[model samples]
Target: MSTSSPSNAISGASSSPSSEDVETIRKNRVLSSKLYFDISDTMVPLIYSSSYDIAFFGLEKLHPFDSSKWGRICQFLIKDGILQQSQIVEPLEASNDDLLVVIKSIFRTLCQKLNLLPKRKTYFGNLNSSSNVSKIIEVPPIALLPHWLVRQKVLYPFRKQRGWAINVGGGFHHCCADKGGGFCVYADISLCITFAFMRLDISRVMIIDLDAHQGNGHEMDFGKDRRVYTLDMYNPDIYPFDFKARAYIDQSVKVKSATSTNVYLKKLDKALEVAGICFKPELIVYNAGTDILDGDPLGELKVSPDGVASRDEKVFRFAKEKNIPLVMLTSGGYMKSSAKVIADSLTNLSNKGLIDLATPPLGTFLCVHM
Candidate 1:
């Protein structure tokens, strides 16, 4: 069984919790737990993201939470002292391609490392048996275009914009071309974006990944396209263990060297400013990762929930204020405090202009509703 604490994920929020809000939080935890539990073990692949959450949130401390549901789901994958493994096979690999063999071998090795059983076949199953695999969800692409086009839409857009912003879970930046993790960075995002554009017959797009981890995959995915400008940020020394020795890259920003929300945001603000001054993108894709929150076990920066909230607000509002069409996605988030980010983001979007809530920041009060 895995063990991680909720407190370990967040140091503290900026304000005190009201008793009523506390009760609501208690109820939400119960609801979230139940929602996760009643789900099937077969759904593990579909919901591995939850395990990512478990790994990040410190499942043991999901107080007032009964983990039996997630526990059973996790353990089943470990039957016969082995967990199951899956891989995203390259679409272009030849039938007898050595790369395919290598990928299969790697899957076997990973299963062995995790003590997991190998389930043969490329995985493409529904998260739930009743669900339609054909209806699989996809991430859109990052849009890089000119400015006046951005002003025509709800989000900041470029002149005659024709791109989209895609989102996904975790900062899976390692899954890029050069990384040997076959497929392009932002592969999911790109595929979705391409399909959307083809279906819509639109052209031009740029991607922006704001996760705490460098958008390594996105960088590789769109490496050759001058039209695709990616901005990835993360600490180079930690996690992904493999890239630690590499020199500080100009392509992506390192949060570890300068660990503060102000610096990170300033860096991002600068990147966006440059993009605005140069690219003039029409469609903006924003990947809002919550792992940057201070005390996040997986995060290196110390941005507060409010800081994250501000980042989201600024990004979306800027786009909206600029009239840019945008598509937003939940990318990386290791901390349960991310729950607050999600709640507040939606609240910010929903309570875009309502006033007289009597609360200093309306976002804080919405957590209770979440």
Candidate 2:
């Protein structure tokens, strides 16, 4: 022990880097990452890919969520002529380096040779990654899927949407920096905001979460950070009742179970009003969930289909009026009708001229300030 020199002691100390070094490493990763792709003027900011659907034998039925809902929504838009296939913007999967910019730990994804449906026996030959995600993902059903597929099919798309883009499959707001839960395997919202701050030179961001349940994930991640202003409207009597995270919300509007359509819309109007007056943000992340529809069992609210459309219009109008770049995410919807409702809402937004889903379809240039 006495023979240990200064250099030897320095080497023998913790091998991990300090907090400041870790932050520098994250920034470096963000700057070098390819996930923040350039949006061409021709492409609409609507981000989605068919691969976002998670179809496995009957295994998908294990959860009430419609894993195929993302594709269904796109189908309605494309088939109904609301949008053209050429207008859609498809994003590349988030690489390990890209995800590391915000996520503390995630499985090294590697999936190959997979099939879907009744003949779909995916478990044995396809799932190559570790199944030891129980410690990270609190939901047991989510852990059943191989870590690779969760990252590839479910989580990566979320990382691509944050500011001024509509990811048809994202809004996994249940995941944070250190942990993941509620079918969310990665902190996409947090990752995107980090990229916005670091690469896009964005100073302030606003999260307008209108999901049925509280967005505990982003709340926990952005706590004590002034750059993000969160306006969360959720049912207080639902899953993820995170009291600690509630302290971080700049505005919280609680819509009780079975609340009527008009009441919900009024509450939303006031919340938007307060949000506009309180803190104006350079970007708005809209978590537009269909779970609030009347028949949605989980959402437990009585809002009609028209109400959902009205809600979307209000938010889109808010962005339009304030001239803020807004990104909408399809968060949670357990029922089969959720897809149709969301598609209808987008059609309504275009009809109102709040967003030019038809006109040459240019993105708001979220990648850079210029």
Candidate 3:
């Protein structure tokens, strides 16, 4: 119940790069990056690593976030006979060079300055530092550790895999180019899309953010950029009340607190229809957060586990019907049941033939846009 405020340490006024500079730097960095390595034909595009789970000296328990859910999701899938452990693709850590592509210059500078401090001194210098890194991640203990440790343990796994990947961790939708918030320390979604634009040779991308909370990070980062289209359906009464960021969303579907599963799915069906007519994207990034399930302390919506599975099915169906490569990130769910719900949803996706783990070559299905 100890939730961090949305407006905590991050400033909404962080500077954006000039359009020309953004394109130049983002493209160069993404092209020179090593995170987008080739996967073998035998490996599925589902990206995950044991290192993705965060265990901050057992202090993570003090926060409301589920630090271990990422590993648990994979475990459930394996236990249920839906996937084999060897089938999952382990991703390379997103190095500083890779992150420079999408991260704001100011943030990069701040991180560098923090890294320069002596090991004897507290890296952050002040516990109440307004850096917004710890507050946004909701793990106050992280404020005491070195920034390098935070990046290695928490953020490295969020790097983009192939065009079609399920990052069992990372849906940090609240962080942006120059700021971090709502337990989101980095802009993984933005970074992923940028990598796709350059490495995957993708142009138009659509973001289907179905988290219980509005995906303000990517919205803020991609605001007014015509390359990306956002369809965010969230409970407006939740943590981040970012009206300015809301303006960036192409289609905003507001679901009130305590709304039932039936009504939520009905709205999603309509939203997908509207989105189809609005944009013809080559790729879809689905932020599938399970926090909306009933009894979740944060998301507050009343959707059942079955409803969550159906929601993912609809999104996958939409992408398949459109012949677009899809990248899914398990974003923003912290309840103990969050992992199980996501695993079940993935099982459902597999059962429906949306995701084929046993296929010899994932590229056959994913190379549609390429």
Best by lDDT: 3
lDDT of 1 by residue, 1-370 (tens): 0112323322344333334443333333333321111222232111222222222123224322122222232234334222333310001111111112112133333233243444543321111221221111111111222323222221111001111221213223444422322111223344333333433343555566666666555454556656555655667665554453122232465678337778767877776666666555556556666777887666667887777867777777667666765655555565545654555544554467421111222121100000
- Tens digits of lDDT, candidate 3, 227-343: 999999999999899999999999999999999999999999999999999999998999999989999899999999999999999999999998987888888786999999999
Among all candidates shown, the one with the greatest TM-score: 3
Worst 10 residues of 1 by lDDT: 154-163
- Give the poorly placed runs of model 2, Cα more than 4 Å off: 1-18, 104-164, 362-370
Q: Model 1 lDDT vs. the true structure? A: 0.41
The lDDT ranking, best first, is 3, 2, 1
lDDT of each: 0.41, 0.74, 0.76
RMSD (Å) of each candidate, 1 decimal:
22.5, 8.8, 8.5
For model 2, residues 133-232, the per-residue Cα lDDT tens digits are: 4333333565566677665544444444433467787788887776666766667778778888998788999999999989999999898899999999
Q: What C-alpha lDDT, on a 0 to 100 scale, does residue 369 get in candidate 2?
A: 10
C-alpha TM-score for every candidate: 0.48, 0.83, 0.84
Residue 270 error, candidate 2, Å:
0.6
Q: Is candidate 2 or candidate 3 better by TM-score?
A: 3
